[model samples]
Target: MVADKSPKAGVQSVERTFELLEIIASVGGSAALGVLAEHSDLPLPTIHRLLRTLSAMGYVRQLPNKHYALGPKLIRLGESAARLIGSWSQQHLRELVERTGESANMAVMDSDMAVYVAQVPSPHSMRMFTEVGRRVHLHSTGVGKALLMQLPNDAISALVSRTGLPAATENTLTTPDALLRDIDLSRGRGYAVDEGEQEIGVRCFAVPVPDAPTLTAISISGPAARVTLKSATKVAPLLKRIAREVASEFDEHAAG
Candidate 1:
């Protein structure tokens, strides 16, 4: 399908505003309003008005130097969008939650941590706890391992050097060699399993979110009583299928 053309009615203002944001992003961070106006081919008055409106809406930020950049609202909006698309994984996560009665989540690597972009909560009284922006170390979580498998050995080594294998729990991998071995095993198995690594008694089964430019992963998690090796064996294929579907959705969205 053809993508929607920009500057639709009533959103011409938004289009112009994003145009300025594009200019700033193109400049590799921030830009003066005059340069933005020139780049967007809009009049100074119009650019100022659109920018003012965007700033008020929190989509554009004004730096101390009077330059404009994308704001926190962009992250908020992107998260909202991620959730919408993440709903594709919801059917699977919900099923996993229902079958295992545990919390299920889909996360992506953002710098050094795994951020929960989407989640399906268990209805049980004792459930795994997590939120959208919840970030956890790469070496300590199942979702992190799933995503880390996508990186090359050299890159993984670099990340290990940068983050250091800090143990979240006694069960957590505290050495680069151990973590590397786990990553390799996860890649070989086409899934990653966390056994009381991130938290005591919490187990997770994870698969990589495919078709992304960078690493992204999703997992179903719960207490060890419910999310055992046998349970993960049952859920692995399902999680991989859902992750692939979500990845395709993301690919299409990015292409559009």
Candidate 2:
């Protein structure tokens, strides 16, 4: 690929190659070469060449059906990112599950949604289930509100205006006024709560993700019956403590 620096700078090959990886990542880890080429607007030969290099580098994998997917190398890289927050979340999450006897998760805001970055399950066969990498609306999740608390009130209001609190369940807070009130409460108290707003019969309590620099949000969720006020009262303090620890560890790592 020759540089077109004589006049208008053309697209860089390395940049386009990473963009193709992003396209694959956007499509939930996998996509066909044709789709990637079309989506990236790169020539088919160029895409094939890039895929070959990426595959060799262990950043991408080629399927038997000729599709390409993000490879384990990305997982290793993400695990490194997670370690940047201290690998203790796994230990803390398990302890939380044992204490509450319900499923728990830690997630971070990915754009306008929250993505489950880590999870630990209760010993029960029937418990709340949230897969890693799952995306949920920021307006309807504890992690969402926790992350929102990081931004200023005016900024949050603007985001709500843009995203619009589309109703997930009838119980969901769709009005801007209601959500703003809830955000204020979450900020004042240091944790966010979901009462069957996202899913009926599912209650969640989320503490503000500490450390604005890492942009991490942490949360715990389970059945409403088990995660009710009485149970939450028991768990809230612990959740806040762990969230602070995670944030503090990340901050220390960054400082070091």
TM of each candidate vs. truth: 0.68, 0.66
Off by over 4 Å in 1: 1-81, 251-256
lDDT, candidate 2, 1-256, per-residue tens: 9756774465688888889988886554689977897788888998988889999999999889888988878867765675444355788788788788887788775545677778887788767788877888887988788877787778777777667888888889998889889999988887889888888888888887565454567777877877887776778898988787777666666667
Candidate 2: where are CA atoms >4 Å away? 1-88
In Å, residue 155's CA in model 1 sits off its true spot by 0.7
Q: RMSD, each candidate, Å? A: 7.0, 9.3
Residue 73 shift from truth in candidate 2, angstroms: 14
RMSD of 2: 9.3
Estimate the lDDT of model 1.
0.79
> Which candidate number maximizes TM-score?
1
What are the per-residue Cα lDDT tens digits for candidate 1 across 1-256? 7767765435677677666776765454567977886788888989888888888988888999898878887777667766675676677677767766778888876655678877889897777889887888888899999878888877788778777888878999998888899999999989998889989999988888777744678788888887788876678888887777777777776778
Clashing residue pairs, backbone N/CA/C < 3 A, model 1: none
lDDT of 2 at 129: 85
